[model samples]
Target: MSSSLASLALVQQKTGAAQLDRFGDPTIVGVALAYFAVIVGVSVWAARRTRTASDFFVAGHGIGLVALTVASVSTSVSGFAFIGGPGLLYSVGLGALFLILPAAVTNVLGAWVLAKRMRLLGEVRGLMTVPDAIGARYRSPMAQGLSGIAILVGIVGYMATNCLAMGYVLDAIFGVGVTWGIWIGMGVTLAYSVAGGILAGIYNDVFQGTLMAVASSAVFVYVLKLGGGMAGLSNAITPTDAGFLGPFGKMTPLAALSLFFVFGMGSLGQPQAVHKYYMLRDPKQLKWYPMLKTVGQLVVLLLYFGVGVGVKALVSAQRMAPLAKPDAATPSFLLQFTPALLAGIVFAGVAAATMGATNSFINIGAAVVTHDLPTALGRPLRNELRWGRISTLVLALLAGLIAQYSGALVAFLGVFGWGLFASTTVPALAIGLNWAGATRAGAIASIVTGLATTLTLETLAYLKLYAFPAGVSGTAVGLVLSLLVFFAGSWLTRARAAAAIDGDVRLVMDV
Candidate 1:
């Protein structure tokens, strides 16, 4: 039995080692190119239909439910599910559950708090972007502009993280320099985004999301086989290091739970995820959105669950050496153990998903810059569709530049981006829109507080200048403070009769 295990482990190690020599693998490159062509084709199809400002921004408010469900899953998951999530689990053990266990709950929560109301509001108000919703809710252009600015700041950081993650996969597949990969990845994403705007992004996401689902499920099955059974997998690890099986791994309980709170509550603020509301053709269809969306997300996320545990099990079985770092977990395992074709498929799927997700950010950031911010300052553009395209190109380039030059620092951007979005937007948009007591002053203050807390704490955490208590993260702390400030300001400054929320909005909230 021992000899058989040793032989199996040796075979796994040898296969894993082959990843380094796969640069010229035609099968991998061919699969990648095919996926790229599909994305471009989808974008072009969507771009043709995007003739007006309305069409460019929200797919003419006529997207199918299946597309919306998949796009939401795609935008919500991003490179984090494919690369970072698994890597964190492999390196940090159970602490990574803090990052993911909230996923299903949050999906349900977002759907409950946002889905129906957001769609109804968009139809009633002609809302296009998230800032539009916040602005409409508060009747303050300044509040809208500030929300736009906050979103753009976080979008830049979010784009930087995606570009960096994409670059790693591109480099591993093609033997190109990381810098080259970053430019190529950004350029491809910007091409479709600038040409088709949100219309392009949504369609691309539908395509990318489907591929990600299929690829991830396949890789997960392979992970199970490689790690033996779940029992075998567990036995391989628990005997040597029992901590790996702990509820919070090595992290403090507070930190683990903080992950839950931040992800669950903060998800309300993510524009890309919620912005899908603007494109839906039927508000009534959203009743079932949570179920379908969760299924898709869970499918893609299986890779995260499988690879994280599989790699740990392999290491414990003495079949594999420890990783150099956490982020390398996905790329390392894929290249080393999976068939070359499967590795390439996943590589392309992640790159596609990364670029597809980035396009949504670029689309919204452009909308804010060309429409929301300028309109708030009393200079709305007439040629909005044109400006949306131009702004997307410029913003994508800027994010790509930041991603390339910031090097390893881009990792910090992921944490900061997620935290900033949730902290800033949830109060003003999520709670404020639902609660009539929410005032302009309260909205602006919440946005500012969220912006300041997340930026200051995350930067300090990165610099090791301010270490959050073990279980409490910058995101959790920032969100709690922002909520407190928002509620306090709302209590102090009553809403005026002149600027009261729309009667219809109030009725919707009641139901």
Candidate 2:
């Protein structure tokens, strides 16, 4: 019996080794090269149009509704949806769905709360960055500067997450070591971002978003076949791990609900998606954004749900071994189960998500460094265009280092960044724009509170020094505290609201 067990172990080891050997197929390598060449072509085309700081930052406010919608979807989805998302689903079971469940309504909420006002404000007052909108709303450079600081922090964390994902996908596709994959991935993304700016990012997003939609939909069909549909998936997983299909899966109820709440409300504060509203040529098109974005997100998110359950079901049925790590779910499924060509497309889709998001963050980080921070400090640069490009390089380098050293999983890093942005920006930027009674003091207070609480709690948790009880997230705590402070501070400074908000800002909000 002992010898039989040894033989089984040997077989499993060989299976794992065989799976590793499948990484760099010629078909996949060819597809990846072809896709990248197309991306370079798009970047070159966009570079010609990106002559000014305004063009670099916001595509010169000339993007059409469809392009803007797709770009927004691509940025919002990112590597988290394609790679980290499935990993989370594999790790947490049903609980992972909480992270994206709010997509159904968040886009509509964003449209009603911020999109029209943001675009109108940009057109009226020439607003360029997310903090610029905050500064205009509250009439405070200090508020803008603090907001910029928080955005910069979140951007680095978020960029590192995407860069890490790019490392994984590139490694799987090219058979490069993860370290080389990271460096190569950053180089490719940085080249286009530095050359074409947001214009390149936007058009590339249009292409990438389309590819993701097609690949995700097609791959989901394969997932269904492998999992034998919902019934087979349940039969396989339930007998071995019944809890995985429960409402909250392995997570405590509180944790699942917290995820839902944070991700739901947090969408309002994500600059990568919200900032694109400024690029829409016509504010009248804002009415369609919610529906269009919701449909697009739902369609593209198929791979997020499909790959995870498919991998889990296969493992439960003893068809595949348990994954070495949750993040391996997507790549493993692609390589082991799908056709080589389909795997290549999905692999490219992963790169598309990571590179697109990295581009957005670098652009925002650049604007923060070159335009927002300097202006808030009353030292605005004369050549923001040149400085913005340089700042992108610097920010990319810093984030790449973080990606290299951080031991956290891609999904967790993405969550931290999301939480940071939600806590810091939601009350100050999203709420402040819609509420007439929000004072500059309140905005500053919320930003300070959010930034302080999130950074402190996340840092402590990361160091293993402390953790919240099950179901309680540090992000939720920070966001709740920030909201409380925002209201309290505004109440205390209620008389200053009229003085804080400009007449034009009031008109735009009212409209």
Candidate 3:
């Protein structure tokens, strides 16, 4: 009987592999290839104009509102929306809606409050990266060095997350190894990113964003239909599986809190999202950014929640039991149900999403390494454009290497990346923008405290020391500690450092 069971397991694996190969439609591959080719072509065209460091890093601050909007949306969605979003909805019900709210708030606040300031500063100070802003504001090498290192670390993980998602999708659809997926995804991204720099990233994002939006809408509609329409699908699924219907559905108190903290507070520190402000043509464009960002966020929420809940209803737990990996759910759904053409389009969109995100990180990370770090270290690195392109390739390769080994879900990888950024930068960024008393010492303390607490909590959770409640998350703790350290440390040290810190904060706030 044991031998028979073992044999049955082997047969199931072989059968699944065979079905995947048989279903590997070449037309879909062709569409994907064409989409990638167009992106590469655009990058090659843009490369000629990328002659300076500023042009390479920030597109010479000339990106119009439309391109900026598309790039912003593309970077914001990334692999998380395509793969992790559906996966969360598939497993958790409606709890995923919570993710949308925080991001929306971030965009709105960013446009109204942060966007103008970032643009003004980028223009006035010739700032090219986040650490550049931080370093200039504080006039401290330690602060800049720490912030740059933190950005590099966080972005590498974030980029790896995209590669991980791409790898999972390819593995599911093509019966290929995860390593193959990483290499292919990385190679395609590097081809454009290394050649065209920020210009390539922006144009590809515009193209990819349009594709993603259309494909997402179609997928949402189809999934809704497959689940017997929205109302019927909701009714068919068990109450335990209806978390996708409401903000607070079925989530534990802790789990709900984690969602709010991770998604909401964490948004303030996302470099890819924040950097969009620096790329806008003018501060006046901020008026339209909120609307564009909101629409994108809403579309993302609907697409992920709809498909997730629908897939849950369409497939029984027993059937889905084999596809336990969340990252595999999106591809599995397309392969199992959708027509070949639609599936191929959706697949291309997924690939585009990952590329958009990976390229965004590459752009940001390159800026940090090539522009920000050199400025912070007081080292004059000439030929900024050359270094920026080189940095992009280096960071992409590092992320790909990391992605090859990371066995994290797309959402987990994204959240972890967000959390790292939040813990390190949120306190400084928020206070730097608002508070007049925020000092360099306070900012440094906050960074240290936030990083230490977050890393410790994350380590504990990984080791299963004490199960952190889902909603009351580790990042929440880190954020709270960061704020506390910033404020308390400021109060404690304000007497000696008051003049230097107060002057900078007042200058920023008074503007």
Best by TM-score: 2
Worst 10 residues of 3 by lDDT: 315-324
Positional deviation of residue 146's Cα in model 1 after best superposition, in angstroms: 0.7
Residue 412 in candidate 1, Cα distance off native in Å: 3.8
Give the residue spans of candidate 1 off by over 4 A.
Answer: 1-17, 409-411, 495-499
Candidate 2 per-residue C-alpha lDDT over 1-511 given as tens digits, one digit per residue, 9 for 90 to 100: 6985566566568657766777779999888998899999999999998899999999999999999888888888888888899999888898999999999789999999999999999999998899999998988889999999999999999999998889889988977866788789999999999999999999999999989999999989988887888888889899878999999989999999988989999999999988998999988888898999999999999999998888888877767777887887888788778889999998997798789999999999999999999989999999999999999999999988998898888898898999999999999889988899999888899999999999999888889889899957888899999999999999999986877678999999898
Clashes of each: 3, 1, 9
Write down the TM-score of every candidate.
0.94, 0.98, 0.92
Residue 45 deviation, candidate 1, in Å? 1.3
Top-lDDT candidate index = 2
For 6-98, candidate 3 gives per-residue lDDT tens digits of 665665576466447645578777777788788878988988887887777788889998889888888888888888878876766676667
Q: Tell me the lDDT of candidate 2.
A: 0.90
lDDT of 1 at 412: 54
Tens-digit lDDT track of model 1 for 1-511: 6996767667657755576677758888899999889888988887788789888888889998999999888887787677777877886677887777777888888888887788888888888989988888877899999999999999988988888878877887887867888889998998888778888888888888998999999999998888877888899999878898799887788988887788888888999888888888988887788899888988999988888999889877767667766766777788778888998899998998889889889888988998899979999998998988889888988888888886443335676788889899999998986788888888899999999998898878777798777848898898999999998988888847225777776766666
- Model 2 Cα displacement at 377 (Å)? 0.6
